[model samples]
Target: MSELNVVSISAAKLPAGPFIARHLIDGDWRQSADGASFERVSPSHGSVVTLAARGGLRDVDAALFAARQAFDKGRWSRTSGKERATYLLKIADLIDRERDRIALMETLESGKPISQAKAEIEGAADLWRYAASLARTMHGESHNSLGEDILGLVLKEPAGVVAIITPWNFPFLIVSQKLPFALAAGCTAVVKPSEMTPATTVILGELLVEAGIPAGVVNIVLGYGDPVGAAMTADKRVEMVTFTGSTAVGKAIVKAASGTLKKVSLELGGKNPQVIFPDADMTSAVDAVVFGVYFNAGECCNSSSRIIVHEDIAEEFVARTVDLSRKVPFGDPLDPSTQVGAIITPEHQAKIHTHVRNAANSGASVRLGGGPLDVPGLNGQFYQPTVVCDVRSDMPIARDEVFGPVLSVLTFRTLEEAVDLVNGTDYGLSAGVWSENVHTCLEFARRARAGTVWTNTWMDGFAELPFGGMRESGQGRELGRYGLEEFLEAKTVTMRIGRTRTPWVA
Candidate 1:
């Protein structure tokens, strides 16, 4: 086994106390109706990070009412594209200006590396900028060729009162992905970020108000999924629901929304894979495998947790991957050099460990560290960089979304077998193939079941490209033109040029 990559523990000064986070309703910051609040302990520093509002059904009702009013009044929904673009641009500038403050809170609240949080904030700004451009470029279709006397038109209009429920992981970035697109399409929203990571989203609400978004245009409610998310999804006033979280929760949201039959968009979990051919660049493939599994502590929905390597080179590749995984910096998130941070919570940490333990007990080889690590100065949960090889295709760890820094290795002899291994799980979020031959790469790309396929890379994302998954991974896309369309409904307008239609009653 290689030495654990225990980098310097962060000695950064702790905050004076928990940051007070409140709900944003109708352009005003307010507390919960019941005066209930929750405390979030930093998963890295083991200190109280945020004291956030605990919204209930009543809060959800108020937010929904505000969003419904905003949409119906049409102050924002009926605004011209250029006008909407102006608001988004202002928000983007504010995001850039407040990146450090948001990043610091996100790191403390979400247990992500501060550097990564900062980058996500930067990327989120770019997403807003992209959505701004989309706002300006939005258009409708005109069909003058229908007839000389008659013309048909297809107009795109907003799907009002969107309910956005984002998960704890990537809280700020994921909300940025959904909210800006909805706003660009002239939709009002009620947002419920995960209770664990609500501070950054609240900070975003401040930015939104500072950018001069109208009252009730984007109301935010912070609390648990039961009363908060549930109420948001089931409310009759909400026309659409866009969520990013666990597959089980996503299914429940779908069932809840079925009562109203509102439009639903989900970006759920993944056990993504990276297939490595023998002829691929060994160094690059190995590096990517390490980065993919360990990035964001493998809490991400798109984490490349599994790797399918050709039998001819499986041994060498797995060895290289294990070695590289050992070098990934794992320690305090405040330390800029740490690449992997603490697990979000002790419960999640236990879940990650259970998966690895069950796999090892079921005859898999634990190549590297397979349990929790002890950080010198932190009292929070820290998982070791683990690599599991000799994994059977049917093993739980091989197929389940282990959602930790645990890498599973599966071997395949042929391209067919590789593709099968990649598609074996219920997830089809993202997959990658490493190959030197163009033909091999193209064929694998064609055969992969995932929504996003990378030829020689993994998890390289852009605001211009559409992203989501198939099967149990998710439904609907999150970025680009499709993202804007997710919040829009098409209306057909047919007019007779001279009112020359025959009267059917006559």
Candidate 2:
């Protein structure tokens, strides 16, 4: 194993050794049972950042056992809603208090710009606080119209142990989306964060402990997806499994979880579209399109990688978009001014390049960048923001989720054609429509098959609104009151107030 190289962020108030990361199991930190470990390399410089313990099947078993024990023993499950809310609030408070440290860690591990990292950290804190408020407000419905002699009562109960498996793109943000809601719903969880970026999630485990979460209420397992993640899905004790990653892996998780028939929720990949009508504001559309596809280096699941523009304005719009794409600053993730950062891994970077090359080979015009980038003092994986024009809707680049800073431009002649182009892919996670006419916006919003449709904007999300997708983008929703309901089961209870026996019972 290589020695861990420490990176100091003097202005961000980080700890001495920001590289060392560990797993949190049953409210304590420990090494894997087999003593296996992996090197977590920094994406900014391709250097060994830390040595994270590589958990396997045994660790997954321990985590599942812990979560099952906590749920069945009613340690946290029996707590009052207000008590749970209080703990969640404390966790939110701790997140805010240590925002700087956590944000620095996230930037180092994920290679997202420091500014974006800070925003994500604060957003996660807000999500926890929002979930805490929901904990107190969660209530069951009462049906009073049954009859005077009969009564019906509906109750909402937690769904036993939940397995939360998050991706690497947004470590803290994505985990916060599910973990707090599960805790608020009175469900114990075993979290398996992506091995590539596990530091912030592990740090979150520490805060959960400080906030007085009962032992085994929330366990963090660190390792690859094969044994650790697969074990979690196959375990019968885990009643629910929620995952956020590629659609391919999501399908495998669903199949494995079928053995025990676990309730599963997936937030999968996307090849989302941004439709720019000719009547739209060109400046605003171009700016929003750039930010939509390039934010977080286009690693977001809902990134608008496909831009369907009206043929009338395609030429000008493509030119402006290409110009802006070339100007997007790509450098150190720690730099606040850097708009784009290094790719998560070399393999992923290679995949991005291959996609771009194939697009070119398929006769799509490379309007801007079409290859990797090299920055002084940085030997990490980095790809330039690319904009491809004259792309056919049937091309692989236009249909697949590149998960990189590459945008494919396609032209449409009419509203029906635009909607068809947007819905042509297997994904329906998110879509954006830019039009000044309210009728056009409303029409497109209604016709688009996506779960979330934005008008004149892109990638706008709120804690109070439900977010999810249709078709291959995945099932179930995240955030808002709906997110809390995902971890709960509804039960109906009927009582006889008068004569109990039915006529047929005699």
Candidate 3:
């Protein structure tokens, strides 16, 4: 690890500039090899905050080269897991030290509310710590089978160079969920943070260097998704691709890797279901459903796009969820008092707007909000908290990932109907089953098609919990022991100890 100094800068102390380069690589800040750049527009004020380097295929190659070299020749993968763990710990310490800047930058770039960004940053630092702990735990198994002398031993080896592609939604927080685990598995990585939200990812690279990670072990390439993203996806050198984005793009990455047969892990777009049974706590169900959709302005893939309530409690749940959602304000991301902020970019805002507009045209009732609002202090890309009830599973708004503050409410009577409605969507990313009844929870949890099932809570859990999906929500998993395994490959070693009679069956 390099001895770069990151001890002095605080979240509150990040220096403002004609922002140099947002891409971090080769242990320093740098521009795209092509010398092109893009302006980062603040969705809050509709003004340019900075012009960051516009990277291309050249940058992708450079980043991949650095990561590949680090993995193959720099001894990063050869370092003892215990020894490498110290570097992860040091990086965690640095992340904690610079928590404020990290969080603030995330908000400033991603246009999420300040409080949420702060929480995400703090969570990121904790994520690093958690992943560090898991480093020692990314262990393979030794079992006594096929006779003790067979000596069945499985070794989990790092999957060489990793390409981590993150989205604009959660920025560093999402990357945080992937990176520490990748590092824990001893894989060198080339990170492709979204072109729109690349600031903190670059800053994070600085902290990693200061924490003593060797140069090239972690590299960042910033640019458009096509050339840069396609480069990483198609590059035969990248052994594994850990991506978090739209299901459309995730599928592309998976398909692209077919040539190299590269390993792929994805947390793709979701139309998650939140099923509320008749026996559920009505108040808790309403609150969970409301928060699930509005938190992060419904940008979350796991947001409760489909709210399935027993017909018995449907009316009351809808009323309470609407009341609570009204309390959420859409405003400036910088305001600590703000609960919701602008969508990530104008394009995304337009996408959400189109969904709402089309939903109304298709006969869905706009229960609360389904349009853009002009705030006194903020305007640009801010979208109002929206609720759409009387929705059919076939409606585009009900099935597609709008990725904004929009909720689709549907009613179900029997448990069978609830299960069918929840599983109706093509996506199976995550689902929530709300019931005080253990049998209901257990049965729903067992049968839910999504990757995760939450009881009485939404987006509440530990890093040790595994997160991923069953079908088109993308392949593989993230977090927990499963997350560590994505960056690892298990090898079986067998030695002859007692007999050398391979020709005869014993």
Q: Where is model 3 more than 4 Å wrong at Cα?
A: 1-18, 498-506
Off by over 4 Å in 1: none
lDDT of 3 by residue, 1-506 (tens): 01111111113332355344466776667888878998887776666665789888878887888888888995689888787788888887887888777777677677777788888888887888888888876678887777756778899999999999999888988899999989999999999889888888888888887887888899998888888888998899999999999888988888898899999898898999888888888887887887888788888888887788788878888888877777765677776777777778877788899999998899899988777766664545777777898888789988888888888988888888888888887889899988888999999898889888988888886788988887879889888888888899999987667765467656
- Per residue, candidate 1 scores C-alpha lDDT tens digits across 1-506 of 23877866767777888899999999999999999999999999889999999998888888888988889999799999999999999999999999999999999988899999999999999999999999999998999998899899999999888999999989989999999999999999999999999999999999999989999999999999988899899889999999999999999999999999999999999999999998999999999999999999999998999999989998888888887887888989999888999899999999999999899999999999899988887888889999999899999998889889999999998998888889888999999999999999999899899889998998899999999999999999999899999999999999899978889998
Better of 1 and 2 by lDDT: 1
- Which candidate has the highest TM-score of all? 1
**Stretches of model 2 off by over 4 angstroms after superposition:** 1-18, 503-505
Q: How many times do residue backbones clash in model 1?
A: 0
Lowest summed-lDDT stretch of 10 residues in model 1?
Answer: 1-10
Residues 105-176, model 2: lDDT tens digits: 788888888889999999999999999999999989888788777788889999989999999999999999
The candidate scoring highest on lDDT is: 1
Worst 10 residues of 3 by lDDT: 1-10
What residue pairs are clashing in model 1? none
lDDT of each: 0.92, 0.89, 0.82
Q: Candidates 1 and 3: which is better by TM-score?
A: 1
